[model samples]
Target: MKWLWRSIASLALGLGALGVVLPGLPTTPFLLLAAWAGARGWPQMEQRLLRHPKYGPVIIDWRERRAVPRKAKWMASALMLSSLVSIWLLPAPMLLRWFLTLFLPCVALWLWSRPNS
Candidate 1:
């Protein structure tokens, strides 16, 4: 069980790191997941993540307040909109496109509803 949690932590952390450099790949959610998993299996890793210079504050803000930075909210919304446009332009099926059309707005609404950090 510990190993499984550790594996999830490692994988999520890797993806979160990649998200830092990859446009439209969200960094905060994966980092949050990584921290959650690390807490279960690896206290040291969790501490390290919480102490990170760049991401630590964001994580702490979320854990303490369920807060999302306003800038992050806007950026995420923009990315989602761009993705929806790209999907619409592709030869994707109408059902999938429609699903995203409905889902993305709901997600954006929820994100916007969160308290700003």
Candidate 2:
């Protein structure tokens, strides 16, 4: 069980790291997941994440207040819009593009609706 949890935490951390560079990838949620899993299964990993210079502050903000930073919100919205535009430009199946079109906008809307911290 511990090993399984550790694996999941590692995976979440990997995704979170990827999110750092990729617009709309959402680093916070995955970092939170990594933190939760590490706390349960690997304290050292949790501590490492907490100590990380870049990722740590965002997690701290979320922990201290259920607040999403204004910059993050705007970046996410922009990315989602860009992705939606890319989807439209691509010659993918209409259904798939439509699904991405609908999904990304809703996500952006929800992110925009969150209170600024």
Candidate 3:
């Protein structure tokens, strides 16, 4: 069980690291997941993540307030809007496109509704 938690933590941390350099790939959520899992099996890793200079504050803010920074909300919105436009332009099935079309706005709305950290 500890190993399983550690593995999840490692995987999520890797993805979160990748998200730092990859556009539209969110970093905070995966890091949050990593920290959560780490707390169960790897306290050291969790501490390291929490102490990280760049991401630590945001993670702490989220844990304490369930807040989302206003800048992140805008960036997420812009990315989702671009993705929606790209989906519409793609030669894909209407159903999938429609699903994303409906989904992205709901995500944006939910993101926007969060308190700014």
Candidate 4:
């Protein structure tokens, strides 16, 4: 059971890392989950996550101060805007478009509102 959790956490973090390259996929939230899961399932993985260059500081900031860097805030905001624009332009269902538009911007806002560290 513990190993299962560790695998799941590692998978989530790996997917999150992949999200870094794939647009519209989230990074921080998944990393947060990975950190949470690592705490319970794999201390070593957690430590590795903390030591990661791209994600480590963000995780640490979130853990210590619930903060994100200012650059991250701007990047998140821009990505959300781009996503919203793509949703509008895409020939998707109205419900799907509305849902993403409403939900993603709110997420961006919440993330942006956090204090930058």
Candidate 5:
């Protein structure tokens, strides 16, 4: 199953890379998955991710402390807010807007509660 894990790792890494540049595409979760799969299938790949300039510290912080960096927390919250605002301003149904209005805050709360690493 090592080959299967390696394939999953490769796919997750690719998606994580795309997430880094694509708005609304989350990076950390995918990177986290990649790291897990990489550890099982390709040790070098996992090490390289752990050594990545941008995402390495984040992965390590999460693994070691289950924490989020303050900067990351702020950025994520801001992005969520912006997305909410965009949704509000769009021509979507009122119910959809209401759902997002309620949902985004709950997401923000969870994000804010994480210890800063």
Candidate 6:
């Protein structure tokens, strides 16, 4: 189980790192997942994440206060919504469009509900 969690964290961190360069990919969420998983499965990785210069503060804020910076929230929301809209408008399958339609707004609501860090 621990190894499974560590693998999940590693994969999430890789994707999050990639998200740094990808236009619509979400960096913070995956990083947050990595940090959470690492805490249980890989303490060293957790420490490294918490010690990171840019991502650390955001993680700390979330862990300490369940908050997210307003700028991050807006950016995440915009990217999520725009991606959803694109999928909705494109020739994607009905199931994918419907899933996104239901999912993205819930994500937005959760994001917006977080207190600003």
Show the colliding residue pairs in model 1. none
On lDDT, the leading prediction is 1
TM-score of each: 0.97, 0.81, 0.94, 0.83, 0.82, 0.87
Give, for candidate 1, the lowest lDDT window spanning 10 residues: 52-61
- The alpha-carbon lDDT assigned to residue 63 of candidate 1 equals 96
Model number with the top TM-score: 1
Model 4 regions lying over 4 Å from their true place: none
The models' CA-based lDDT, in order, is: 0.95, 0.85, 0.93, 0.87, 0.91, 0.93
Cα deviation at 19, candidate 2, in Å, is 3.8
Give the Cα error of residue 94 in candidate 4, in Å. 1.1
lDDT of 5 by residue, 1-117 (tens): 999999999999999899989987878889999999999999999999999998899999999988998877888888999989999887889999999899999989998898998
Positional deviation of 33 in candidate 2, in angstroms? 2.3
Q: How far in Å is the alpha carbon of 109 misplaced in model 2?
A: 1.7
Ranking by lDDT: 1, 6, 3, 5, 4, 2
Residue 87: error of model 2 in Å?
0.7
lDDT of 6 by residue, 11-71 (tens): 9999999999998787998999999999999999999999999999999999999999998
Give candidate 6's error at residue 12 in angstroms: 1.1
Tens digit of per-residue lDDT, candidate 2, span 37-103: 9988999998888899877777777777767789888877887888888888878899989899778
Model 5 weakest 10-residue run by lDDT: 69-78
- Candidate 5 TM-score, C-alpha based: 0.82
Cα error of candidate 3 at position 16, Å = 1.0
Segments of candidate 5 deviating more than 4 angstroms: none
Lowest-scoring 10 consecutive residues by lDDT in candidate 6?
Answer: 81-90
Preferred candidate (lDDT higher): 5 or 6? 6
Of the candidates numbered 3 and 4, which has the greater TM-score value? Answer: 3
| lDDT tens per residue, model 4, 1-117 | 898889889889888988889976778879988988999989898999899998899899999999988877887788788978987897889999989978987898888788888
lDDT of 1 by residue, 1-117 (tens): 999999999999999999989988999999999999999999899999999998888899999999999999999999999989999998998999999999999999999999999
Tens-place lDDT per residue, model 3, 1-117, is 999999999999999999989998988889999999999999999999999998888889989998988888888899999999998998989998999999999999999888998
Off by over 4 Å in 2: 21-26
Quality of model 4 by C-alpha lDDT: 0.87
